[model samples]
Target: MATHFHKKPNLYPAHVQLKVSDLARSIEYYTTIIGFKVLQRTGSEAYLTADGQTILVSLIEIQNAQPLQRGFAGLYHLALLLPSRKDLGNIVQHFVNLNIRLGAADHDVSEALYLNDPDGNGIEIYIDRDESEWTWFDDGQVNMVTEQLNFQPILTAADGNWTGLPAETVMGHVHLSVANLDKSEQFYTNVLDYNVVTRYGTQALFVSTGKYHHHFGLNTWNSNNGQAPEENMVGLKSVTIVLKDEHYAEEVKQSLNANGFIVENFAEAPAYGGAQLFSTVDPNGLRILFTLDGE
Candidate 1:
């Protein structure tokens, strides 16, 4: 059988859940700076949407949530992908106007802007380059490099329209800081069946399905052999990976069990209501939700 990357459609990163020390402060930052609309707020938790309908981010307020520790196995960043370069330019201009300190990068597959939320959670706003423009290596890997981003050209492309995140926006990818590369790779690749698109030597690895560059990135730059974040620590709670095909979801459960990984099936839960999905923990103690279209 062909590998997962050669499949018809890839799994989509639906949403991310984060624990924050202050709900009000985090909500303001996400709405004003990141351009997310408040879908709903229930008690100490708030659901944020990019397209005014779907919940893409959730923030749960914890009274004594500890700050994320360096070199810990947890979230590195959650990336938001714009539908077009023009949309990215609009946000870039907004950042410039607000004097937000941003870090920019030109990865061969995408152009990205990086920032941190009020509680120091990492965020990446980016747009993917055309697939035809991507360069592929003989090893079935794509060339992705971090170089200086030319701001002038991107700024010139802006149409000067200031609005919130477009309806087509999506949670592009999630990068994680893991304790062990080999163990994480075994789970994400061997069991989950993602294709390794590329690597940054021994420090990082990128994996994707349907050959669309990357949906997940794992790295040990600052987290090698580190401990998992504490329960009350402010960091990643979980990331939802949505599979479009029901058969694929069943296959994933079988693969997880065969590989000795435990899987919990949630028929209908408030977290992902109306969907038949399963949850599993990676070697580094990160929660991954695998779901089908509907129950």
Candidate 2:
């Protein structure tokens, strides 16, 4: 799989925090079905890893947490990028063996399979086609389309041996349901400095740094003019973006302040281990945590 898109110098999502109603059930689903291993656990929270060390996803068990509702500004899905086509096939066969229902699609740049967790938090597992195969237009928009995925070819690539998530798996990208496309687009592109890579009419847009297809997919399909999910709801809590270093993190914080956004520092938090961490809410109320790489 391509590494440059997610490495230092490109702003990308590295971790996600989700609120779920049942910790054990969600843990079971993530481990057994999604192939994540537990990196840490507390009474009410669990951190998951694809490799043995990095925390890719976290689940916080909310007391009396409500089910995920539609028309809210929250998670659309957090995508997991696999390393190879063979790995994708292995998981597909595993899903078939477990009788899991899925929505599959080919997006020109990648092939993806979608499913939801026990708490209805959406998840996407996908493999990118080679970068050389991608099409770019003169206006700086990368071509992408949703079409039927040919499953037979992917299934045939499986070695019939399914384990867990590969060590190389990374938090590929995140798709969000937001209140307004224009505001969200401006915040992501102008304030956060991501370039617009693609658009689905006026309802949705894709943005990324370093010319990767996209690091974020923003859409108002179900959430146009809607409110954010309540704090006690079972859904996305925050998404963490790993910047290249403290310099970039500071730049982002300054940009947020300049744009009339509130940036809160969490640098002294024990959980963050003295990293220069800061967080701010987007226009639609989605919280985003900004931190440096290797923190």
Candidate 3:
């Protein structure tokens, strides 16, 4: 197990380097279609920042790497982390002004707004509540539930409009779609050691670390006994997980392997605090990477 290869200076975290099929098409869809702004770009890659979180959809124009398969364990959703509930409130106001209706839910630990990207990747914009406020069961399990999220306060002029968020926000969590909820929860929470935030019978489950709400979510929405995706469909390119320190990152990479998650390679991602990213293929064969936070 290795660690991040770059320097991390802040708490702002995100999953960077999403490999895509067509760089131009993805860039167009993110910028024009999904309303993301282009932060930077090189020969074949483009970095886009949305609501203050900087993410790079790196278009590796190579004849290698595992091809994407739909119907399999693709991205369940990409959560755009907000600074606070006030930050989320402003975003709600933005949607209100645009006459866009969004799905709101309180997962006991977080307040979230659910929507979709241009390519059908589920997107969740959210803010975490105080850790002390997170409930726990008598058996020591974290308790989470879907509740009503109040948006009226945010829509008021007094709260402020959340149009262009600053760069302090992040990608707090990455949710996934699996064939079975229990099985997925076992892999993430039990195997990976994330505390169980909660579960919804057989439909879905949520997990997190240090009771900071949910760092991961799993659901059996469209894929009960799910099938892997095809090579042509555009879905979750890859998910980057940021860790705290080089030692911690190194620890996680080894833990993943000991837990039976087959690791492909250990690469030097100096862009991510010099963290060593160990990519793994799940039962559904989705590529998930672990890296470090960005500045």
Best-fitting candidate, scored by lDDT: 2
Tell me how candidate 2 scores on lDDT.
0.90
The C-alpha stretches of model 2 lying farther than 4 A from their native spots are 270-276
Per-residue lDDT tens digits for candidate 3, residues 1-295, read: 0012112422222564454556777777556533466766777667777643355333332234355444467777777766666667666766667676578898767778888654456777777777668787876667777789776754552276444653555667778888767667766665555777567777877776655556677787777787765445556656665566778766766877788887766645544223546677666656667665444
Residue pairs with backbone overlap in model 2: none
Candidate 3 similarity to native, TM-score: 0.76
Model 2 is weakest, by summed lDDT over 10 consecutive residues, at 267-276
lDDT scores in order = 0.84, 0.90, 0.62
In candidate 2, what are the lDDT values of residues 1-295, reduced to their tens digit? 7889998888888888999999999999999999999988988999999888888898999998988877899999999999988999999999999999999999999999999998888999999999999999999999999999999989888898788999999989999999999999889999998999999999999999999999999999889998988989999999988888777778898999999999998747424212438889999999998877443
Predicted structure 1, TM vs. truth: 0.94
Query: Against the true structure, candidate 1 has what lDDT?
Result: 0.84
Candidate 1 regions with alpha-carbon error over 4 angstroms: 1-8, 271-276
- lDDT (10s digit) by residue, model 1, range 124-174: 999888888899989999999999998887888899896889877777889
User: Sorted by TM-score, highest first, which candidate order results?
Assistant: 2, 1, 3
Any residue pairs clashing in model 1, and if so which?
A: none
